[model samples]
Target: MEEWERWERRVQTAAHPVAYRLMRAVAARGPAVRVPRVGVVVSDAGLARQVLTDTEAYTKTGPGAAAALWSPVLGSRVLITLEGAEHAALRRRLGGLFTQGHVAGVCERVLRAPLGGLERRLAAGEEVDLVGVVRDGAAEVIRELVGLPAGGSDFTEAAAVVSSVRLWRRSLTGRQLHRARAALARLSEAAVESYRSGDESTVPGRLRALGLDEAEARGAVGLFLLTGTETLVSFVPRLVALAHDTGRGPDEITDALVEEALRVTSPTPVMLRSAARAGRIGGVRVEAGERVVIVTLLCTGAYGPFSPERDPSETAGLRRLWFGAGPHFCLGMPLAMAETRAVADALRGFPDLAIAGRRPARGVLIPAYARLSLRAAR
Candidate 1:
C-alpha cells in the first residue's frame, strides 16, 4: 500500500477497528451483501445512489434508519430525521443559510483570525497541530451558526454523544439515550434562549423568523452541532496529509484535488437507510425494516487509489457521492467546501508545509487525526 493509504487505514481502524474490518470483508463479497446482523451492505456507487434516491422503497424515517438513531435526542422535526413533504419544507426554509455567498461570508468572518494565526505560526517555522487548528475553526463557525456564546456549549460533549453510536445498532441504548439527550440539552440551551428572543441576528432567531417553531429551531441547532463540526474536523487535516504524502504541494491542491481527496477519504464513511418495503437492490432481495448500510468508503474506493493526475471523468460516476445524493444531499456542502477552501488557501501560502507527526483518534464515529503536527519542511 502507498504511505498515504496506509496512514488513512490507520485512521479508520483506530476509530473503528472491528467495524472497518467487517465493512471491508462485506465489500469483498460483492456489490451488495446481506449480512446476518448488519442487514444489506451496498458497496457499489450506482446501487448506493439508487437506494438513496428511491425514497419510495428506502427512507430515513423507516425502522432502523437515521430517524430511529437520532430523532430521540434531536427531536422528531430535525431535517435529517424527517421525510417526504416535511423534510423538503424544512430544507427549503433553512436553505438560505447555506447559499454560497452566505456560507462564504460565515467562513470569512469566523475563520480569518484562526487561519491567519495558522499562517503566522507556520511562517515562523513553528510546528503546529493542524487538527487542533481545524477543530478550533470549526467550533467557532458552528458557534456562530448555532447562536451560542463563545463558551456556550462544549463541542466535545456533542462529539461524545456521537462516539457512543455503534455501527450495527439501530438505536442508542437506554443509557446511551439518556446521555445523548443530556449532552444535547446542554448544548441547545443558548439556542433555545435565542429562539425565544426572536432576534434574527442569530441562527435560531433566523429559524424563528423562517416560521420554524421553537422545537424545530432547537432540533436544528442540535443537528448542526452534530453534523457541522466533526466532518470538517475529520476531513481538512486528511486533505493536507494526502497532499503532503503524494508530494503535491499546496500549489497543486486545486478544487479537483480537494474533490479527489474527499472521494478517497470518504469523511462520512457510511450512510444508513432502512427498507420501507420489500425491494431488490442490485439483485439482492431486502425485506421491509432491514437496514441498508452504504459503505461509502468502499463504494468510492472501488474507483481506485488517489490520483489527481487522472481525469475528473474517472470520478464523474460518483456525482460527489461522498457528500450524498437525492433530497438528503448534504445541506452543509457549500459551507463545507467554503471551509475547506479557506484552509487550503491559507496552506497554499506555504508550499513547504510538511507533516511532522499525527495520531489517529480512537473510539469515535468519525475517523480523524487527533493530532497532525505540521511544520515548514527543513
Candidate 2:
C-alpha cells in the first residue's frame, strides 16, 4: 500500500488499534511523516511538545474539516484558536472555576441527584439503556451548570450539533454545510439566552465574570456545550463498559479506574497546530504556516514516556490530555472529570448492569456509541 493510503486507512480504524498503524508509519519513514496538506504528524511526545509548545513554529490550527464550524463560534482567537499569551490568559481565567473544591462539589451533587435515580431504576431489575442514562446524567449536570432547559432531548440535540460540526469539518457538501452553520447559530443563540438573566448562575456567569459581552458570551457558551458534551458522553459509557469487562465489582470500581479510563481512552485524539515559523521536529522540517496534528493518545501511554507511576495523584496521569495541553487545554476539564467519575461510581453499584448490544463509533474527533443498549442484572 502507498504511504498516504496507509495513513488514511489507519485514520479510519478504532482508537485502541491506531497505535499499531502509527508505529508502522513511524517505522516506515521514521517519527515524522508527511500527512499531505496537514504537514507532519509527530508521534513522539518530546517532538510534539517542541512543535506544539514552541509557539514560534506551530500555531493552534483546527483540522481542515471543522475549522470553519469552530472558527465562527470560538473565533480565531479564543483559547482553542489563539496562541501564546492570549491563549494562556484565557486558560488561566477559566482554570479557577475548576478548582478541586469546585469539582468535588459538582461531583457530589451529580452523584446525589440524577446518577442516584438511575441506579435505583437499574437495581429494580429495569432494563435500562445505560448509554441514555449516563448521557442524560452528564447532559443534565452540564445544562444545570450552564442553565439550559431539561427534557432529555437536549442531550440528543447537542450531540447532533457536535456531529454536524464533525461532518462539516471532514467532508460536508454545500447544502449540508449551510444547514450546519444555521444550526450552530441557533444553538449559540439559545446558549447565550440561558446566561442572560442576572438571576441565572449558569456558565454565562463565568463568561460574564471574564468580562465577555453578550455576543462573546454566546460564542463562549456555544463552544462550551459543543466541546463539553462530546467528551463526557463519550467517556462516561466507556468507563462503565470497562468496569463491566474487567469484572470490577462495586467494591472494585474506584475513582482511580475512572481517571485511568480517561487517560487510557482519550476521546479527544488530535490537537491541531499550524507552524508559526520554520522549524524541525522528529527529524522532519516544517515550514511556516504548516499544519500539524499531534496524536495525544499515543503519548499518554505505551512504550516509554509519561509513565502512569510517575504521577500518583488522584487523577493526574488520567488527565494528561484530558483537557489537552499548551494554550488550548480544556476549560471544562474539572467539571467533566467530576461528573464522569460520579456517574461511573453510581453505575458500578448496580452489579447486574449488562450492555445489551451496539458497539461504539470511533472517529478522528468524536467517539461514542450509536446505540448503547442495556438490561437488568441477569
Candidate 3:
C-alpha cells in the first residue's frame, strides 16, 4: 500500500479497531452482508445510494435508525431525527442558513484569525499541530453558528456524547442518554438566551426569525455541535497529511483534491438507517426494523486508491456518497466545504509543507489524527 493509504488505515483502525476490521471483512463477503447483530451492511456505492434514496423502505426515523440514537438528545424536531413532511419542511426553513454565500461569509468571519496564525507559524518554520488548530477553528465556527459565547467545553462535550455510541448499538444506554442530554443542555444555554433575545445577528436568533420555536432552535444548536464540529476536526489535518504523503504540493490542493480526500477518508465512515419495511438491498433481504449500516469508506474505496487524476467518471455514480444521498443529504455541505477550502488555502501558502510527526486518535467515533505536526521543509 502507499504510505498515505497505510497511515489512513492506521487512523481508521485506531479509532475503531474491531469495527474497521469487521467492516472490511464484511465487504469482502459481498456488497451486502447481514451479520447477526449489525444488521445488513451495505458496501456498494450504488446499493448504498439505493437504500439512502428509497425513503419508503428505509428511513432515519425507524427503530434502529439515526433518530433512535440522536432524537433523545437533540429532540424529535431536529432535522436528523425527522422524516417525510416534517423533515422536508425543517430542511427548507434551515436551508437559508447554509447557502454558499452565507457559509462562505461565516467561514471567513470565524476562520480568519486562526488560519492567519497557521500561515504565520508555518512561514516562520515552526512546527504546528494541525489537529489542535483544526479543533480550535472548528470550535469557533460551531460556537458562532450556535451563538454561544467565546469559550466553553462545547466541542469536548459534544465529542464525549458521540464517543459513547458504538456501531452495533441502536441507542445510547440510560446513563449515556442522561449524560448526553446534560452535556447538550449545558452547551445550549447561551443559544437559548440568544433565541429569546431574537437579535437576528446570531444564528440562534436567525433560527427564531426562521420560525423555529425555542425547542427547535435549541435542538438545531445541539445538532450543529455534534455534526459540524468533529467532522472538520477529523478531515482538515488528514487532507494536508494525505497531500504531503502522496508527494502532492500546495498547488495541488484544489476542490477536486478536497473531494478526492473526502472520498478516501470518509470522515463519517458509517451511516445508520433502519428498514422501514421489508425490502431488498443489493439482493439481500432486509426485514423491517433491522438496521442498515452503510459503510461509506468501503463503498467509495471500491473505486480505487486516492488519486486526484482519476477520472471524474469513476465516482460519478457515487454522487459524493460520502456526504450522503437524497433528501437526507448533508445540509451543512457548503459550510463543510467552505471550511475545508479555507484550511487547505491557508496551508497552500507553504509550498514546502511537510508532516513532521503524527499520531492517530484511538477509541473515538471519527478516525483522525490525534496530532499531525506540520512544518516547512528546510
TM-score of each: 0.97, 0.80, 0.97
Q: Rank the candidates by lDDT, best first.
A: 1, 3, 2
For every candidate, C-alpha RMSD to the true structure in Å: 1.2, 5.5, 1.2
Q: After superposition, how far is residue 129 of candidate 1 from its true place, in Å?
A: 0.7
Q: After superposition, how far is residue 161 of candidate 2 from its true place, in Å?
A: 3.5
> For residues 1-378, what per-residue lDDT tens digits would candidate 1 score against the true structure?
899999999999999999999989888989999998888999999999999999889999888789999989999999989888999999999998889999898899999999999989998889999988998899889889778888644577777778768777788999888987888888888889989999999899999999999999999888988899789989999999999999888767999899999999999999999998898998999999999999999999999999988999988989999999999999999999999999999988888888888999998888999999999764
Clash count list over all predictions: 0, 6, 0
Write down the TM-score for model 1: 0.97
Better candidate number, 1 or 3, judged by lDDT? 1
lDDT of 3 by residue, 223-335 (tens): 98888878988998899888889998876898888889999999999999999889888889999999999999999999899999888887888889999999999998998
The numbered model that scores best in lDDT is: 1
* lDDT of each residue in 34-70, candidate 2, tens digit only: 7674457766556665665566556655344234346
Query: Model 3 misses residue 37 by how many Å?
Result: 1.1
**Candidate achieving higher TM-score, 2 or 3:** 3
Return the lDDT, model 2, position 308.
Answer: 28
Candidate 2: lDDT over CA atoms?
A: 0.59
